[model samples]
Target: MSEAVARHWRSGHVDVEFLPVGAGSYHWRASTPKRPPLFVTVDDLDRKPFLGADADTVYARLRSALETARALRQSGMEFVVAPIEGRDGNVLSRIGRRYALAVYPYLGEPRAFGNALTAEERVALKAMLVRLHAAPKAVASLPRSVPAEVPFRRELELALDSVNTAWEDDQYSRAARPLLAANAAAIRGWLERFDELVRISSADNVDVVITHGEPHSGNIVRSGTHFALVDWDTVGLAPRERDLWLVGGGEPQLCELYRLRWRLDDLSSSVRVLLSPHDPDGDPERALRVLRISIEREPFTRD
Candidate 1:
């Protein structure tokens, strides 16, 4: 076990044995003698730097997660794996200014979405989202300051420029260069359509709600026969469509439950996928193949 994990476990006052597991961030399955096993995730501040330069942001995110979890539990949803407070009563324990450790009671292996979800599972997921959107005000108020709203035209322009620069400057590996070059035109066309869709959605005043940000299959876990949502780091107030898009968009069942009238164009989602930065650590060949399929398979239309 690393020093940070040791320090955090000691501070939490839990006699647990840490077993290292997983890729991406450092994760451990913490087994204790008297208490239930816990899942501990440690983010290296120097590497991720998601909190920016402010320690306050970290505190706010932790508090927001705890508040959201409590609200969900009180609402009779016991699946959210809320953060466990350390001995110092803080969800986030700063370890030597290099790592932040947050702990939660363990949930078993995450349900893989490699295959299509069952109809019953989809219904359950939709119900969970509805309850989450209706969480109490105290939970909604805990997120960090809302980001300034920027026009989609400006945002797309900036992203287009950045993507072009990355390709032209050879910022990515040689294997990725050919793929990016081949799809440049398709990528740009998609962005233009996306910008227009955003304009329409904004003018229509789409409903906003506290969202899980990314509720895709990987983030949803199975606890016994029930399901739970994990990774509250990106939890915040945003367009209800953000989460809906990830879950099935405009499906009659979801629309009836959420009472959503406006349907986001498919291109709107494609733009998001295209704008996402390439993973620095991912396999270049596989990443390129995925990118090509994502752009070419979608019909590029303009208004």
Candidate 2:
């Protein structure tokens, strides 16, 4: 990884140290004598976000999103923590068959995943989101437009329907099968309510804009006195409510739609993980935990 980073970024020499910071990506802190430290991120282009996309397609979307962040920062929206371009004039470097890598200027520490946003922090994020929503034209490169609905609802449905059918021979999958069977009706109810909210979202007269899909406190950085957003991987065109829902001032029904999108998306992914052949290890165990939360979450309605 160190060799790859030094070669791609045209760096003198770097000593790399692994940092378990973000999910879905491997992170490292790269130190060079002459220059300040850099944050290096490597992702498996064949997994998760790459599910339907070929490696090339997923790579293109991620690179374009990061480039858009760079352009936004250049356009004076300094809150954008964009990826640094490699010497090849690309934001990402294809490390090997399975993995893709990118470099970024190491901003300081990000907040913990469970930490809630304070009132002032919420205000700051809301103001930043307003600027982001207003400036889709700042960057010539735009990512794919996503639907108003959550991405993984179908997967959730499939998991729920597989109640009678047994999961493959795996401990977690075995446990998940009965859980799904017991909660099938409640999951369906949540889905129905979600669809109802989607109708309201579809009828609303709202402008679509560039959104940082997961701009929760975990993705925000306190830069000096103000906050800046990191992780531009989820950047895309969507209704303003998608982001405004996170910070306040969004319409009630629209906000509820997005809120469901968030929980159901996580629930669905967790269900998919459990229904599939997941081993009894770190991620699979975590999926079981998330599955519990998804069904029991207040807004989701176990009834």
Candidate 3:
């Protein structure tokens, strides 16, 4: 990994240290004598979020997404902490067939996931999101648009339908089948409500903009005087609510629509992981926990 960074970034004698931080991706902090310290991110393109996308396809879209972010940052949007381009000018570099790499200026300011947002932070984040929503470059450059339906929705349906059958794929899949069966009815109702929300929101003319799809505290940080956002991997052209719902200050119905969108995305992805063969590096257990909570928790219940 250090060799790859040095080769691509043209930095000599990189010192790479693994940082176990984000879910579904590998991170490292790399330093060199010639340039400032950099943050490195590597992802397995064949799993979870990129399951259906082959390496080349995911690479193209991710490169475009990060480029959009770079454009936003260059536009003087201080909150956009975009990717640092490689020597070849592409935003991402292929790491064999299964993985890809990207680099960024190391912020070294990671906020803990699930930490409660203070009132001041909430206000600042809301204002930052408002500025992001109005940026025209995001709409013009985004390669992928936020889908109206929850991600992994089809896989979730298949899991629910196959819950009664024995899953011989693996121990985790076998265990997951029964658990899914127990909550099949409630899960179906949740999907129906999600679709209903989609119908209602679709009828209203909501402005679509570049969204930092997961703008939770873990992704937003205080950069000097401004609150900057990181993790531009999920950036896309979407409704303002796609980002706003998490931060509050939006309409109750719209916020609830997206809040449900978030959970359903979580539940569906977890179910898909358990139903199929997946990476076991703490992912299966995490998926199981998300599946368990998602099924038991009532819809519209705030955490």
Model 1: per-residue Cα lDDT at residue 113: 35
Model 2, residue 254: displacement in angstroms? 1.5
Which has the higher lDDT value, candidate number 1 or candidate number 3? 3
Q: What is the lDDT of residue 69 in candidate 2?
A: 85
Which pairs in model 2 have colliding backbones?
Answer: none
Residue 271, candidate 1: C-alpha displacement in angstroms: 14
Q: Evaluate model 1: give its lDDT.
A: 0.54
Question: TM-scores for all candidates?
Answer: 0.69, 0.89, 0.88
lDDT digits (tens) for residues 53-80 of candidate 2: 5777777777777887887887889999
Q: Candidate 3 residues 1-303, lDDT tens each?
A: 899998988566889999978877789999888677898999777653542456667767777778888888888787888888888887888888888899988888466676767787888888888888788753456547766567788989988887777775777777678888887897788788888888777764766677777888778788777678888877777677777777667666767788888788878888777765654544677788777777676543323
Instruction: State candidate 3's TM-score.
Output: 0.88
Q: How many residue pairs clash in each candidate?
A: 0, 0, 0
Q: Using alpha carbons, what is the TM-score of model 2?
A: 0.89
Model 2, runs deviating above 4 Å? 50-52, 136-141, 279-282, 299-303
- lDDT to native, each model: 0.54, 0.77, 0.77
What TM-score does prediction 1 earn? 0.69
lDDT of 3 at 119: 82
